[model samples]
Target: MTKSDFPALRMTIDGGRLVPAGPFDAERLNSYRRGTVVYVRFTEEKDRVLVRKWFAIIDIVLKQCQTPWKNRDQAHEAIKLALGIVNLSKTVGGDYMQYPKSITALEDPELQEALEQMTELLSRMTGVDVATLKKETAHIVEYEDHGPTTGEIIEHESGAASPDADEPPSSSSAGAAESPSSAAPTNTDTTETPVADLVSVETSGDGDAPTPSPGARDPETQRLIDFAKDVLPLAANTETTGSLLSAIEKEWAPEIKKMSADGQEKAKAISRSMRAIFNRQASLNGALDFFSDALGCSVEELGG
Candidate 1:
């Protein structure tokens, strides 16, 4: 029988028995045999937006579930990512406040199955054992405030340590003290160094006297590291190399173009830099290297 021919399924909500509110459009009904519910068609604009948002949420959740580090922390991170996508899709879909309520109201088995699939996808993406994901979901439902904030959890997973504001400095701080004359110069001065000079410096000393990594170098490395840090948050939320590349392309397009004789070279340089950064070739150092190679200039020159 066709969707219109099939009788509308009845469901209860808020202690009231509610029948399917809208006309059953066959084309819109996606039926899942496992759950005898039929997903409704998007007749209203709000419903349409909800569908779009839900789709995006599902996509992100699925991707995260498939990630290799499946755990409560990872699940928490995935939820945060899904929530962010939900927020953005809400804006794109045009009904931000109504989403939660509408999602709660959906009774179609097909829709339920979709959500289930999303959860499963999340489990897979995160590399969390299925049993573990289920247990964590239940725990999250029970706990009120244990859930970590998106920023906190994501930063942790990304290898950034949270600053403990309440804790006092450790005794080691006493030994680490340096006189003003010995103190390092401001970041601005360091970031302006030429790429050639940056490459010339050894990133490390002998094993006994280890030195700071590339990120600890002068201002140019520091600046790029800062830029990479900002991009991590954005990347976790949406597609593309976080959003830095997009911003740079838009904001610096004119300046970048003016630098090259025909602008094509500048465009190529920007593209190369983006690929290197997003691919995680070698962290911020690699990004700088890519830029230097593209521009045929030293890192010091770029900084200057």
Candidate 2:
């Protein structure tokens, strides 16, 4: 089943059927009165049961690792690390690929503490923060100068040709005091000269390129880009991504409804990020604006 079917619970395939995992304590599940024992029933062959169950565990752990933290950036890093760990485990078959065990192998005490840590972190990361994370992770641009200025090269060449020049340069010494006693008068003029050369070289090589000015991108635009790069990754799987967007909608929808036209405009920008799955664009926009404005910042600020 999709994340929409069960808002609170995280679902993964277990025994060839989807089963809820994560922070839904027994009390929370019992309150819903859904059923006493939550087990997955599959029609697949008996031999495949264990394999499917193991897959389910892997999925759940992978999903959990991607869950956001109080600091969205940190959470995103955590998720990437988690994904890497899971991917590594997949390379090695058997019980080592199981859920909580696989996650625990990372030796992260924070992850082991409680499943709610993921939800709490995501909630804490503001839009601006998410935006910042996105910008940081985006491709790096390099800046370069084409070549040295004409005057600089000329001066360099002139300096380098000094020793071979026809004209002899003047000396600064005048009315110098004579030595009281000298064994012999030396006629040799000793000069140590430094020279600069106009070497034909590519100052800006193929690898060196100028970075576009930050001003080229609007703050809002950059923030949006960042949100896509950073926050989206936290929602590693389809279910997590959907749930996160849903949570944003549910929590901020009411506030969004009360926003002004200008606020609405900002909301629209945020809606674009959720366009793929968020059906209620208007509502999502409003909700995003509300959250941003409520926090005395833009959506970019929160996502950053």
Question: TM-score for each prediction?
Answer: 0.19, 0.18
Candidate 1 C-alpha lDDT tens digits along 66-182: 222233333333332322211222456663321112343455564544454444433322323334333322211111111122111111111222252112111221321111211
lDDT per residue as tens, model 2, 121-190: 2222222122222222122111221113211111111122333122111111221111111112543322
Task: At residue 203, give the lDDT of candidate 2.
Answer: 23
Candidate 1 residue spans exceeding 4 A from truth: 1-241, 259-263, 281-283, 293-304
Highest lDDT: give the candidate number.
Answer: 1
Candidate 1: C-alpha RMSD to true structure equals: 20.7
Scored by TM-score, the top model is 1
Q: After best superposition, candidate 1 residue 261: deviation in angstroms?
A: 4.2
Error at 33, model 2, angstroms:
75
